[model samples]
Target: MNKQKIAVLGPGSWGTALSQVLNDNGHEVRIWGNVPEQIDEINQFHTNKRYFKDIVLDPAIKAYKELSEALDGVDAVLLVVPTKVMRLVAKQVAETLDHKVVVMHASKGLEPESHKRLSTVLEEEIPAALRSEVVVVSGPSHAEETIIRDLTLISAASKDMETAQYVQTLFSNHYFRLYTNNDVIGVETAGALKNIIAVGAGALHGLGYGDNAKAAIIARGLTEITRLGVEMGANPLTYSGLSGVGDLIVTGTSVHSRNWRAGDQLGRGEKLEDIERNMGMVIEGISTTKVAYELAQELGVYMPITQAIYSVIYQGASIEEAIKHIMSSEFRQENEWS
Candidate 1:
C-alpha cells in the first residue's frame, strides 16, 4: 500500500490506538485533540499518559491542537470523537477541509436528539462535495488491547464498496485486520445498540449474578438489538456478524468496556453523575439507553432488556427492581421471530 497522511480527530484512547496502527502501517499520522496538555504530552514525551498510561507512542505520530493543521494535506480523516460532540467536530472539520477526503468514524452511539447514526450526523454536518462516502469502522476490538499490538479484527463498512475496500487496505496489517462489509446500517446499528446490553451485563455482574445470568443477558440482548436493527432496515443476518454478536460479546464481558464499568458502578449503588465523572470517559450506553428506549417506543419494538436498562439509568429505578421487572415480564419463545 502506498504511504498516506491521515488525520485522526479525537485523541482519546481509540483514536490514539488507531493512530499507532496507521503509523505502524508506514503512514504519516497526525492526531488532533481539544486538550492542549495531552497534545503537548504526545509531541514531547511521545505518550498520552492519561489514556495509555505507560505506552509510548511512535515519535512519528504528530499531535496537533489546531484542527486545520491536522487536516492539512491528509488523504483521509479517522473520527473517533464522542457521539455527543460528533456533529460539532464534523462541522469544524468541514470548515477546515479544503478538498474531498475519505471520512471514516469509529465512534459508536446514536444521536440522542435526532436518533440518527454517527455516519448520518457526519453526512449532514459535512458538505457533500468535500467528503467521500462516509464509512464506519467497528467490531469487537477494544482500545486498551489494540494499543498493545494485540491481534484485533474489525469491519470497515460503507454503502459504497469501493470506499469500504479503500479503508480496509489503508488500515489492514498483521496485527490489525479489516473486513469490508456493505451492511453499514446493520454494522452501525449493532455497534451502537450493543453498548446498552453491555451496561446491563455490568449491572448484573455488580448485582452478584453469575455467568448464567450474563449469558442470558447477552443472548436476549442480541435479540432486542436485532429486533431494533431490523426495524431500522438492517439485515437480520448482520446481527450475527462481527459488529453484531462479535461486538456485543466483547463489550458486554470485558473489563475494558466503559459502558460495562459504568453499569457495574450503577449496580453497586453509585450515582450516574459520579460514575461519569470518575470514569473520565464517555460511557456510550448511558445516553444510548435513552435513545434506544425512545426509538423502540417509536418503532413499536419490544426491547425488554433495553427498556429495563433505560429505567434503571434514566428513571432511577433500582437495579434489583429492574432485574425483577425483566424476569417477571411475559415469557416468549426463545427464537420468536415475530
Candidate 2:
C-alpha cells in the first residue's frame, strides 16, 4: 500500500476513530480540532473527552490546534465534521492548503435552507482543483462501535475510480472494509436521505408499531428517496448500495444513532425543543427533514414520509397528527410507481 500522510480534521467521535484507524495503518496521522482544549486533551491523554470517551486514541496520531499545522505535511484529508459545521471547517482548511487533496467526508446531510449536499457545498467552497479530489465516504458505520474496532462497511464515491480506489486503501483496515463507487451523486444523496427516513422509522418504532408496520414504513421511505434521486438523474442501483439501504438499516435501528434517538423521543411524546436542548450534539435528521421535504416538493416527487417528519419537526405539528395524516391519506398499491 502506498503510504500517504493523512490528516483527520474534526474533534468528533467519528473523526477521532478514523484518525486512530489511520494511525493503526502505519501512516503518519495528524488530527486537527477547531477547539484548543480538544487539541490539548488528545495530545496529553490520547482520548477525546467530549466525544469518544474512555477510548484511547492511537499514539501514532498527533494532535494539532492550528489548522495549518495539521495540513502542512498531510497528503489527504478526511473531513468528518457534522453537516452544519462542514463549510466553516472547509474554509479554514482552504486558507492553509492549496494542493488537490483526497477530501473525504463522513457527514450525511444537505444544508437545511440551501438544500445543497455536503459534496456540492464542498465543491463550491473549496477550490475547483480540490473539487476533482473531493470524495464522499459513507456507509453503515457508527462512531461508537468503530472506536472498539468493530466490523464496518463504507463506500468511496467519486467520479475518478483511481481516486475512489486510493480512498478505499486509505481507510481499509482488518476490522473495517471499503468499497469503491463512481456514482458520487447517488451515493451522497442516499447517505443524506436515509437519515431523514431513519428518523421516521424510529418514530414509528417508538409509537409501539409492530415489525410489519416498521418494515412497511422503511420500504415506503426508500421508495420516496428513490423517486427523488431518480428524478435528479441518479442511478437506481446506487440507491440500493451500501450508502443507501445499508446506512438506512443501521441508522434506523442503532441506539447510538442521534437521529434515531431524537425521533424516538418525539414519538414518545417529547417535544422537538426539549430533545434538541438535551442532545447538545446535532441530530442531523431534524435539519435534513426540512431539506428533504422541500426538495421533494421542488422536484415534484411524492415523499409522504419526509413530509410527515418535516411537519412534526419544523411545522409545530403534533406527532399524533402526523401519524393520522400518513395512515388516513394513503391507500395506494405497493410498487404503484413502478
Candidate 3:
C-alpha cells in the first residue's frame, strides 16, 4: 500500500485508535481535538488518558489543537467526533481545506433536530469541490477493543463504490479489516439505529433479566431497526450485513458500548443527567432514542422497543413497566411487515 498522510479530526478514543491503525499501516496521521490539554498529553506523552486511560498511543501519531494544521496537505480525513457536533466540526474542516480530500466519518447517530445522517450533514457543511463523496465507516468495532489491536471487521460505505473502495484500502490492515459497500443509506441507518437497541439490551441486563431476555431484545430490536431503515429508503438486505445485525449484536452485548452502559444505568434507576455527567463522553443512544421514536411516528413505522426505551428515558416510564408492556403487546407473524 502506498503511504498516505491522513488527518483524524477528533482525538477521542475512536479517533486515537483509528490514528494508531493508520500509523501502523505506514501512513502519516495528524489528529485534531478541541481540548488543548488532551492534545498536549498526546503530543508530549503519547497518551490520551481522558479517553484511553493508561494506553500509550503511537509516538508517530501527532496531535494538533489547530484544525488547519491538522488538515494541511492531508490526503484524507477521518471524522470520529460525536454526532451532536459533527456539523460544527465539518464546517471547521471545510474552511481549512485547500484541495479535495476523501472524507470519512465513523460517528454513529442521527442529527436529533433534523434527523439527518452524519454523511448528509458533512455534505451540507463541506463544499463538494473540497471533499470527495462522504464515506461512512461503521460496524461492530469499539475503540477500546480496536486500540488493543483486537480483530475487528467494519464496513466503509458510500453511494460511490470507488470511494468506498478507496476508504477500504486506506484503513484495512492485519488486525483491522474493512469491506466496501455501496449502500450508504443502509449502512448509516443501521449504524445509527443499532445504538437504540443496545440501550434496550443494556436495560434488560440491568433489570436482572437473563441472556434469554437480552436475546429477545436483540431480535425484536433488529426488526424495529429494519422497519425504520426500510422506510428511510435503505435496502432491506443491508440490515443483515455487517452494518446491521453484526453491529447490533456487538453493541447490544458489549459493556464497551456507551449506549448500552447508559441504558444499564437507567435500568438501575439513574437519571439521564447523572448518566451523562458520569459518562464524560457522549451517550449517543439517549438522543438517538428520541430521534428514532419521533421518526418512527412520522414515518408510520411500528417500533415498540424504540418507543419503550424512549419512554424510559424521556417520559420517565419505569423499566419494569416498559418491559411488561412490550411482553403483553399483541403478537404478529415473525415476518409480518410493519
Q: lDDT per model, in order?
A: 0.93, 0.83, 0.92
Candidate 2 structure quality by residue, lDDT tens digits, 1-338:
76789888877878887887777778898988778888898888888878775788776688988788888867888888888888888888777796777788888888767888888788878897754557888988898998899998999988889988988898898988999998877888888888888888788777888788778777888888888888877889987889888888888877898888888888888878899899877888888878888888888898888888888887888877988898999488877653
TM-score of each: 0.99, 0.96, 0.98
Rank order (by lDDT, best first): 1, 3, 2
Off by over 4 Å in 1: none
Model 1's TM-score against the true structure: 0.99
- For lDDT, the strongest prediction is 1
Quote the positional error of residue 239 for candidate 3 in Å.
1.1
Q: Higher-lDDT candidate among 2 and 3?
A: 3
**Candidate 2 local lDDT, residue 48:** 85
Model 3 TM-score on a 0 to 1 scale: 0.98
Per-residue alpha-carbon lDDT of candidate 3 for residues 1-338, written as tens digits (9 for 90 to 100)? 69999999988888889999999999999999999998999999999888888799788999998888999899999999998999999999888899999999999999978999999999999999998999999998899999999999999999888888988998898999999988889999999999999999988888788999988999888998999999999999989999999999999999999989988888888888998999999888889999999999999999999999888888988999998998899978889878
